[model samples]
Each structure stands twice: as C-alpha cells, then as structure tokens.
Target: MQDLNPTGTLHIGASDLEYRMIGSAPADAPTLVMLHEGLGSAALWGDFPDRLAAATGCGVFVYSRAGYGASSPVTLPRRLDYMHVEALEVLPALLDAIGFRRGLLLGHSDGASIAAIYAGGVQDHRVQGVVMIAPHFIVEDISVASIAEIKAAYETTDLKSKLQRWHGDVDNAFYGWNSAWLDPKFRDWDIREYLAYIRVPVAILQGADDRYGTIRQIEIAREECYCPVDVTIMAGAGHSPHREAAGATLEAIVEFANAVLQGDEGARGRAA
Candidate 1:
C-alpha cells in the first residue's frame, strides 16, 4: 500500500541508471524479480509484489525500466533490440546491485519476452526458473490486431489520460511500446528458439481469450523448450491473467515454484 520505490543506481555503459526497487528486504532470500508489461512500471504493480513476496517467502524486486514511472524516460521510437538490452545488459547489473545471485523471473507481456531472452543468454548464474505470463516470442496477426485497437483507444478514448496516472512520461511508455510492436519488421520476432536453450523450469500461462496471442503461441513455446514445460490456459481471461483472474494465476505460480524447487533437489543440479 505504501509507495514502494527504493532508489538505487545500476551502471550501464556510460550512464548510471537508477531503479526504484520495492519489497521486503531479504538480501539473501530467493529473489523474485517483477518485470512489468509494455506500459507498466514499478508503481503500476500496485500491491502485487508485496503480497507475492509474503506468499512465497521470497524477497520481491520491482523496478521501472529506463523510461517508465520514476526511471529515466527514453527519447523516441524504440527497437526490437530494446528487450535484449534490458535482459542481457540492465538486468544483470540490477541483480548485482541488489546482491541477488539468482531469482525467479515473473514477467508479463513484453516483460515476458525480455525474461525469455535473459533465460537464454545467461552463462553461469541464472534464474532458478521463470514464470512467464502472456509471453510471446513472435508477432501474430492477433497481436497486431490487438495493438491496433489500443492505438485507436489511445487516440479516441480516455485511455491515454488513464495511463498517465501510472507513468511519469506517458508518451514515452505509450508510443515506444505501441510503435515497436506495430512495426512491420517486428512480425518476424520470436524468442522460442532462444528459450529452447533455457535449462530452468518454465510455466507459461495465458488466457485462452487473450486478444494479443493465439493458442499456437503457447503450443510453440511448449514444444521448443526441453525443460519440463507447463502451459495453462485460463479460459475466460484475457491478456492479463493477474488482472483478470488473480487468484487462479497466483495459485499457478505457487504450484510452479514449489515444483521447481523440489525438482532441483533430486536432479544433479544445473551447471555452476
């Protein structure tokens, strides 16, 4: 309920970027980093992170990327590489700054895509597992169609003003995400191949009614990865399982985490 933005800087390239971390301080506890959606930030998570930490007994970390909420805002049109930058570059720095060795990744929408990239790219110390909500590796006709509807609403409805409540620079969050996803070149984007390399456990949850992705997206993801993959379709829900059906989604995450931890003990354990 209280404002949850503990300021800390992460050095990336020539710039020192600051992140607003929020949650109970459990420096050594198994961590669970919250990655927000395309238009999301630390503030946008509301009380979900705190509640989740309490549920799992894992220290939760939530931060706004460079240009959302309290973080520095970007200038213009973004790129497909932006997600890569967040995962391979910024995320490692943040984990180090926070003294977290490895944690669970809880990502939604575009955040899920970035988490997928990070899962694939890590060399030695990586997350124990990942819980991706509505993750997409490739663009689909459904995604494009949904994005177009959002653009329409932003231009014609009160949605832009509503979004401004969560983002300090609403335009940066809006156009940067909208333009990149709608870009013609973005259609070929798919992280499933990269995800195949992920050695950690993964649970992909999606709403069967999700306008942005088809069932094929989840099917493809389930097929590519060698790890034990569990894909759940929240029948009546939409793009946001956490928002539309929080109870069911939280139950799924709890079950998934317990399974991963238990499995790790029996196996030889991952390469160190």
Candidate 2:
C-alpha cells in the first residue's frame, strides 16, 4: 500500500484515481472513505471532508472514480451494472491499496449505492459501518426524469462548462453516467438484495425534497437491511444534504461514527 498523503494519485489497475487525505491516517485512526456522487470528483466534495475529519477525529479519504475528476477516462455508455462492478471490483482493491485497517464507508448518490453494495456483497471485516447520503436502492421514475433533464441541460446549457471545472474529461464523465442511467435497460437497475448482506451498522441521510430520489430509498433499506439502520430526514435540504445542510449532516455523521467506532473498540477489548 502506498503512503497516505494530503493529496495524491492511486494507481488501481489501469486507472489512476485522485484522492485526498485529511487528519490522521488509517493506521493511527479509524478512517472514513468518502465516495462522491455520479458527476462528483474528489475536489467537488469541497470542505466537507476536512470538517468531517475535525469533527470525528478520524482520517477522511476522498477519491474520484474513473472517468471523473482527474481520473482516467472510461469508455462511453457505461454498463447498466456499473455500480456493481465498482462495488465488487474497484472498491476492494482501493481499500487494500490505502492500507485501510478499520473504517466506515461514507458515500453519496452513486457513491452511496456503491458503498452499500460493497458492505453487502463483500464480507470485509475492516469496515465497521456505512454512511449513505442520498442513496438509491432501486431506480425510480423521478431519478430517470431528473437524469434526463440533466442530459438536456448538459447539451444545451452551461452545465457541461460548469462540470468541466471538476472533471478533466468532462464529456466522458457526464456522458458515461448520463447515458447509462438514461438507457431504458437501466430502469431495472436494483441493488436492494445487497442490503440484506451488509453486516455493519448503516446510517442514511436523506433530503426531504430531493428531486432525484424519494423516501422509498430509505424504506427499502429499512426493509432489507438486517443490521441496525439509522435514518435522518433533513428537512429543507435537496439532493446534497452535506452541501445544503452542512452542519446538520456533519453532526449526524459524527454522532454515528463515534457510536459505531467506540462500540467496535469495546468489542475488540472484550475479545482480547
């Protein structure tokens, strides 16, 4: 595993993912590995990672997936099961590459879905909990509509230019995610089955008025997850609660991380 630096590139297979590390490293503290949204890059997370590291006293790692940010570009028209591929393939290598000893997977939007899939599909004991922000368990009509609208905006409006600020291959990043979701076959994209396999505690932060997904995402998690599930509906917030209600979001995650990591420590002590 490479050394954890404040900012660096991690070469995973053919992709060199861009990453940022804040506060202590995973060897000295429990880490929070953050997965960005579909169009989000490592830099797009803004100061949330820094605030999270300060609040929780845990290392916060943020990385941009392939085709996003400064990462390597992927072939256009991503597969319908791209999230699954990320969860099963990329994430495991990423965790190992980072020398992650103990940590929680924190994800937003597509990133959230990837985290959930990993927790459920892979039995990695290093991960003790999950924090999902605006996660989607299944494809919703609203999600399709919003994605379609964004595709239109990307083509005819300044959305592409705006996104270009974060992504190196702006078109690849936008079209890869946009084309896959807008594909008719993507309507059947569902990952609720993975929820049942997640062994760690899960915390979900949902926006009350998110345009992309509804409360049903939370409902699916409640129904599918056998582990402890904590849900916080952030009122007056939109799709991105950490961006829209930063303080509340940080507090909620900090509280959950403390409780979960402390409990894990206690359990380890008893075992010892």
Candidate 3:
C-alpha cells in the first residue's frame, strides 16, 4: 500500500477520489475512515474530521466517492445497487490503498449504509467496528418523499450553486444520488440481510425527528444484528447528527471507539 498524503487524490479503479488525512497515519494509530452522506464530500465534512482526530487521538481519513466532491464524475442515472457495488468493490480497494490497519467505519446517510454493507458483506477483520448515522436498511415512503422534495429544491433553489463549492461536477453528484433513490424500483432496496452478517460491534446515532427515516430503522437493526448494537436517539437533531448535534454525537462516537478499539495497540499508544 502507498503512503497517504495529508490531502491528495487517490486513483482507485476508474475514478480519482479526493481524501484528507488528519492526525496520525494508519500505521501509527487506529484510523477512522469517514464516509460522507449522498450529497456530502470530503470538504463538506468541514472540521468534524479534525475534531474527531483530536478527541480520540486516532487518525481520521475522509474521502469523496467516485461522483462526489473533487473526485471523478460518474455516468448519469447511477445503478440502483450503487451502494452495494461501492461497499463490495470500491471500499475494499480504498482501505487497501490507504493501508488501513485497524479502526471503525464511520458513515452518514448513504455513506452509513455503504459502511454497513461492507462490514457485513466483506468480512474484513481490519474494520473493528461501525458507526452509522441515519443509515437506511430499507426505503421508506418518507425517504422517497424527502428525496423528491430535495430534487425540486436542487432544481428551483440555489442548492446546486451551494453544492458546487464542494463538488467539481455538482450535477453528477446531485443527480447520481437523487435520481437513484427516487427511482420507483429503488423502493425495494433493502440491506437487512447485511445486518445479520456484521460480526463487529455497531453504533447507530439517529435523529429523533429525521424526515428521511424513522425509528423503524433502529428496530430493524435490533431485529437482524447479532452483534452488540448501540443506539442513541438525539431528540432535537435531524438526519445529520454529526452536524446537527455535534457535541453529543462526538461524545457518543468517541466513547464507543475507545471501548470497541481498546485492544488496538496503536489506539492504546495514542492514549498513552
């Protein structure tokens, strides 16, 4: 594996992915690999990565997938199984490329779903745990409605202009995610099977009033997962708890990371 620069573009498969490394390298400390939400990118994470690194004393790696941020653009009308492909194919290559040794997979929204799929599907031992924020196991009526609403907002409002600040191909990022979710066939998109296979501990941070998903997501996880499942429902927060309830969300994640990754030599060294 090649050494990761603090900030650089990694050429993975056909796409060039943008990434940022905060604090220690993977070899020196446990690395938290952060996967952004559907409309989010590395830059869109803002200072959360930096804060996570400082709090846990672990390396934080944030990256944009193929169609997001400064990464390469993807073809229009992405596959309905795009998240599955990303989890099974793309993420393994990314972890290997970054020389990921040990840590948690921290993801938000679509990113969270992808992380869960990888953990349950891939059997990668390097992934010590998973932190999922607003993950969707099955498409809900509310999910499709919210996505449709966002599509309208993106077209009529200045949402596209705002997103352009983070994405090189804003339309590609927006439409790729938006179009796939809004597709009628996507209603049957379910990943509950993946939950049954995840061997590591799982932490879910959810917003109580989230418009896109409901408490049933948490219920599904509880039903399917045999591994230890930790749930925190943030009362006032919405879909993006890391952004909406920054302090409490970080505290929950930090506490879980320290607990699950306590056996990691690098993590122990960092704490010392």
Better of 2 and 3 by lDDT: 3
**TM-score for candidate 1:** 0.89
- Candidate 3: segments with Cα more than 4 A from true spot: 265-272
Residue-by-residue lDDT tens digits, candidate 3, 1-272: 87888999988999999999998888778999999999999999999998888878889999999999999999989999999999999999999988888999999999999999999999999999999999999999999999999999999999889999999999999999999999999999999999999999999999988999999999999999999999999979999988889989988898898888887654542221
Residue by residue across 189-210, what tens digits does model 2's lDDT show? 9998999999999999999999
Candidate 1 — which residues are off by over 4 angstroms?
Answer: 1-26, 262-272
Question: Candidate 2, which segments miss by more than 4 Å at Cα?
Answer: 263-272
Which candidate do you rate higher for lDDT, 1 or 2?
Answer: 2
Give RMSD (Å) of candidate 1 vs. truth: 5.2
Worst 10 residues of 3 by lDDT: 263-272
C-alpha TM-score for every candidate: 0.89, 0.96, 0.97
The clash count of every prediction, one per candidate, is: 1, 0, 0
Taking every candidate in turn, the Cα RMSD to the unseen true structure, in Å, is 5.2, 3.7, 1.6
Q: For residues 29-54, write the lDDT of model 1, one tens digit per residue.
A: 56678899998988787777765765
